[model samples]
Target: MSQRIVDHPVLGSLAARNQLRFTFNGTPYSAYEGETIAAALLASGVRTLRVHEEKGTPRGIYCNIGHCYECRVNVDGVPTVRACMTLVQDGMQVTAGTVLPTPLKKGGHSQ
Candidate 1:
């Protein structure tokens, strides 16, 4: 899928802005200065940002706002960052939720 918004019904043609580089699970992607992490990943055709800590259910951006934590991910060693609320920065390292430590076990045991 193309990782760009060529034209918008209301916004018209999106001009090329200063491009920034970031990696998702070691795969590189380009993003603009003002684009959110969720927007960038979605544009790149990435639907799953993380998984359920205990159930292993796939998770992505549920709410574009910061309220929902479904889009939580690891950014530059920091964990539980909301992708929809976080802005993409140049040279940022993003990892999937699968790599994060599970807060609880199958039997509700703290790990």
Candidate 2:
């Protein structure tokens, strides 16, 4: 099943838009013009955008209005760019942010 809303009673039919190509975590995906990165990922069945930076818990789109950062992802080497707010760009490369590795202490133990 397609995640896209093809038709809406109040908004009328969704106008066809040119397809945009992008990648998430090295995997290719397609998006229509004007769709945000989070929307594109959701349409492609990707529910988990990233894990918590420190907790390692899975995080997806929340609030979706740029207030919550759950949908943040790495884009073209930039970190913490909110996927929910950023529009998809052709040839864009996106990556999920993962928990940072614990710092090692002088005795070789994790700090």
Candidate 3:
């Protein structure tokens, strides 16, 4: 079941749009045309888009706009792509960002 707002009080009925396929963390999912990556994931019940770089905390759509970087996810071969600002593309590959281990956590740096 999709969680899209089909009928809004002000926007009325939702217009029919083309459905496209995309992959999130190797899982194939469908998204509507012109919808952002964050929107698609949220509609699919995916809240945690990535984890904190150091603290390992789960991060999801915070601002919804392009201001906050909490919704950053890896797209294709790119890293740190803001999911809220990027539109979902057909066959696009998206992966959740993982927290990088610090020097102290990685055997106190390679020397």
- Please give each candidate's TM-score: 0.83, 0.84, 0.85
Candidates sorted on lDDT, descending: 3, 2, 1
Clash pairs, candidate 1, are none
Question: What is the C-alpha lDDT profile of model 3 across 1-111, one tens digit per residue?
Answer: 689887679755546677899999999988888789999999999999999998898999999998989999999979999999999999999999998978867675898
Worst 10 residues of 2 by lDDT: 102-111
Q: Which candidate is the best by TM-score?
A: 3
Q: Rate the local accuracy (lDDT) of all candidates.
A: 0.87, 0.89, 0.91
Candidate 1 lDDT over 5-108, as tens digits, reads 77678755646567789999999998877889999999999999998876788999998999979999999999999999999999999998884355454654
TM-score of 2: 0.84
Q: Candidate 2's residue-wise lDDT over 1-111, tens digit each?
A: 459886779745657567889999999998888889999999889999999876789999999999989898999999999999999999999999998765443554544
Candidate 3 lDDT score at position 107? 75
For candidate 2, the lDDT comes to: 0.89
Model 1 CA lDDT for position 66: 91
Error of 3 at 62 (Å): 0.3
